[model samples]
Structure formats: C-alpha cells, structure tokens
Target: MRTIRRALDLGCDFFDTAESYGPFVNEELLGRALRGRRDDAVVATKFGWEYEGTARGALNSRPEHIREAVDGSLSRLGTDRIDLLHQHRVDLEVPIEDVAGAVGELIAAGKVLHFGLSEAGASTVRRAHEVCPVSVLQTEYSLWERHLEQEILPVIRDLGIGLVPYSPLGRGFLIHRWVEDS
Candidate 1:
C-alpha cells in the first residue's frame, strides 16, 4: 500500500492489473488503495480466463463470459468503468472478432473507455481492430525479448495503436542481479 501511495505521489497514475493475478487479490488491493482517488488514476485490467471459486481454468473469451468477467472486474476494482480493458490472452477457441465485438459492446455501454490486447499476433490485432479500434497493445517487449519487433510492432504502428510493453525490464531479469547485490 505504501508503494502504491508513493507511486501516486510521484505522479504515477496508470495502473495495470488482471483478474488472473491472484485470481482477484491484486485488483482488490488496487481498488482499496485507489479509494477516493479513482478519478486521478487510469486503471487497466484484463479478463479472459474462466475461474471456479478462485481456481483459474482454461481460456474462455466467449461473449457471455466476457460480460460476466467485466462485471466481476468492475465490482472488484470498485469502479463504474474501466479505463482500459484488455483480453489478457488471445483465446484460440474464441474468434478475435467475437472478442472484439464483445468488448465493443461494453465500450458502447459506457463500461469500458478503451480496448486493448495482450500477447496477440499481427493478424489477430488487425482482425480485432477491424471490429473495434484497439487503443493499445500490451506485449512482453524489452531488449531481452525482441520477438515483437519484427512483426507485431509494424502492424500496431501502422494501425496507430499504442503499445504498452509489459516486462520492460525483462520481467526482472535485468534487476535480478541488482536485487541479489542489495
């Protein structure tokens, strides 16, 4: 909680959390921390997996599941609308268009401000964007992981979609030694 307060103090506002993280714990913490200050922050969360009493199951991005997941996320985050809602992972069973369409409905209904995608390929990004504008694309990108540079980057850049690179420090690999040294 102190760390989150410190970040907010330092003008850090964008916060990203997912339903899968602790299956709900992290979002709860964030919701509590941002209490009375939700307007000052941009909250981003994801929903793509099925959960059975806190036990995460397989990828399930079905339209109906998406609706249920967002409602759960809204309640957990204690927010009326999500600043940015992402499809955590591209579900092979559910078509990208369907996923985008579902999110589009949420956006139209004023439940989500913007749409995002995570770890999605170029083709999938394009298809989803055709259904609904992809405001941002979050992927594992850093010096150590340059896979997206060749294909995904170009596509997102061409589409004018913003990129939110996760694990920018190589998921702590760049700081592992630093932590050990400390």
Candidate 2:
C-alpha cells in the first residue's frame, strides 16, 4: 500500500494489473489503494484465462466470458470503467476476431475505454486490429529481450499501435547486472 501511494505521489498514474495475478486480489488491492484517487490514475487490466475457485485454468476468451470477466474486474477495481483492457494472451481455440469484437462491444458500452493485446504475435495483432483497432500492445521488451525488434515491432509500428513493454528492466536482470558491473 505504501509503495502504491508513493508511486502515485511521484506521478506514476498508469497502473497495469491482470485477473490472473492473484486471480483477483491485486485488482481489489488497487481498488482500495486508489479509493479517492481513481480519477488520477489510468488503470489497465487483462482477461483471457478461466478460473476454477482461484485455480487458473486454460485460456478462455469466449465472448461471453469476456463480458463476465470485465464485470468482475470492474467490481473488484471499484471503478465504473477500465481505462485500457487487454486480452492477457492469445487463445488459439477462439478466433482473434471474436476477441476483438467482444472488446469493441465493451468499448461501445463505455465499460472499457480502449482495447489492448498482450503477448500476441504480428498476425494475430493484425487480424484483431482489423476487427477493432488495438490501442496498445503489451509484451516483454527490454535491452535483454529484443526478439520482437525484427518482426513484431515493425508490424505494430506500421499499424500505429502503441507498445507497452511489460518488463522494460528485463525482470530485474538489468538492475542486477548494473550492480554487479558497478
């Protein structure tokens, strides 16, 4: 809680969370932490997994499930709308078009402000965007991880979609490396 408050105090307004994280606890915490400061923050969260009493199951991005997930997230976050909602992962069983369409409906209903995709490939990104524009793409991008530079990066750049690197610090590797070199 103190960490969150301190981040907010320092102007860290963009926050990202996923239903898969703690399966729900994290969103609840953010909701409580942002009690009165909701307007000051841009909350981004994701859905795409099925859960059975907290035990996360396989990918389930069914259109109906997306609706249920958003409702649950909204309640847990204590926010009327999600600033940027993403599909945590690509579900092969479900077509990307369906996923994007579902999110588009949510956007139209004002439940979600923007649509995003996480860990999706270039082709998937293109197809999804064709159905509904993707505002952002989230992936592991850092000095240590640049695999996307060749293909994925170009595709997103051409589409005019923004990138939200999940681990710009290489998941603590860069920090450790810096300290070791020092």
Candidate 3:
C-alpha cells in the first residue's frame, strides 16, 4: 500500500492492472489504495482471461463476456469508468473484430475511455483497429527485444497508435549499448 502511494506521489499516475493478476486481488488493492484519490491516477486494466476462484484459466472475449467483465472490473476497482481498458491477450477462438466491437460498445457507453491491446500480433492489431481505433499497444519490447520493430512498429506508426514497451530496460536496468530509435 505504501509502495503504491509512494509511486503515485512520484508522478507515476499511470497504473496497469489486470483481472487475471491475482485473479482479482490486484485490482482490489489498487481500488482501496486509490479510494479518495481516484482522479490522481490514470488507471488502465485488462480483461479477457477467465478465472476459477483465484486461478487464471483461459481467454474469453466474446461480446457478452466483455460486457460482464467490465462490470466486475468496475466493482473491483470501485471506479465508475476505467480510464483505459485493454484486451489482455488476443483470444484465438474469437474474431478480432468481435472483440474490438465489444470494447467499442463499452467505449460508447462510457465504461471505457480508450482501448488497447497487449501481447497481440501485428495482424491482429491491424484488424482490431478497423472496428475501434486502437490508442496504444502494450507489448514486450525493449533494447534487447526488437521483434516488435520488424512487424508491429510499422503498422502502429501508420495508424498513429502509441507504443508502450513493457520492459523498456529489458531484463537488466542498464542499457550500455546504443540502440537505434527511428
């Protein structure tokens, strides 16, 4: 709790939580922590993974599921609306368009402010954007990790989507080598 408060004090207002994380504990903790200070933080959470009790199971982004998930998340987070909501992973069983449309509906209803993707492939990103403009892509990218550059970067650039490198420092904190950024 103290750590989270300290982080917020340090101007790190952007918080990312997922329903799968702790199978719901993370959001609960964040919710309690941000009680009176909700406006001070920019909360971004993810949905899609199913859970049994505290155990995370499989991906389910079906339209109806998306609707139910947002309500559960809102209750857990104790917020009226999430600042940003992301599809935790691209569900292979569901069409990207359907998933995007579900989230698009949530945005229209004011349940979500913006939508994004995490750990999604290049092609999936492109398809989802057609339904609802993707505001950001939160993927694993860093100095040592450059796979995203070859395929994902070009598309996000063309679409004017933002890139949020998951671990910009890679495994280690230091980036001794000069990496190219274009």
Report the number of the highest-TM-score candidate: 1
Sorted on lDDT, best first, the list reads 2, 1, 3
Using TM-score as the yardstick, the better of models 1 and 2 is 1
Candidate 1 lDDT over residue span 1-182, tens digit each: 77887899899999999999998999999998998889989999999999899999999999999999999999999999999999999999999999999999999999999999999999999999999999999999888999998899999999999999989898899899789999
Off by over 4 Å in 3: 172-182
TM-score of 2: 0.95
- lDDT: which is higher, 1 or 3? 1
Q: What TM-score, computed on C-alpha atoms, does each candidate reach? A: 0.96, 0.95, 0.91
Structure candidate 1, residue pairs in collision: none
Q: RMSD, model 2, all Cα superposed?
A: 1.3
56-148, model 2: which lDDT tens digit per residue?
Answer: 999999999999999999999999999999999999999999999999999999999999999999999999999999999999998889989
lDDT of 3 by residue, 1-182 (tens): 78888888999899999888787999999999998889999999999977778877788999898888899999999999999899988899999999999999999999999999998888999999999999999998877789988889999999999987787777555454434331
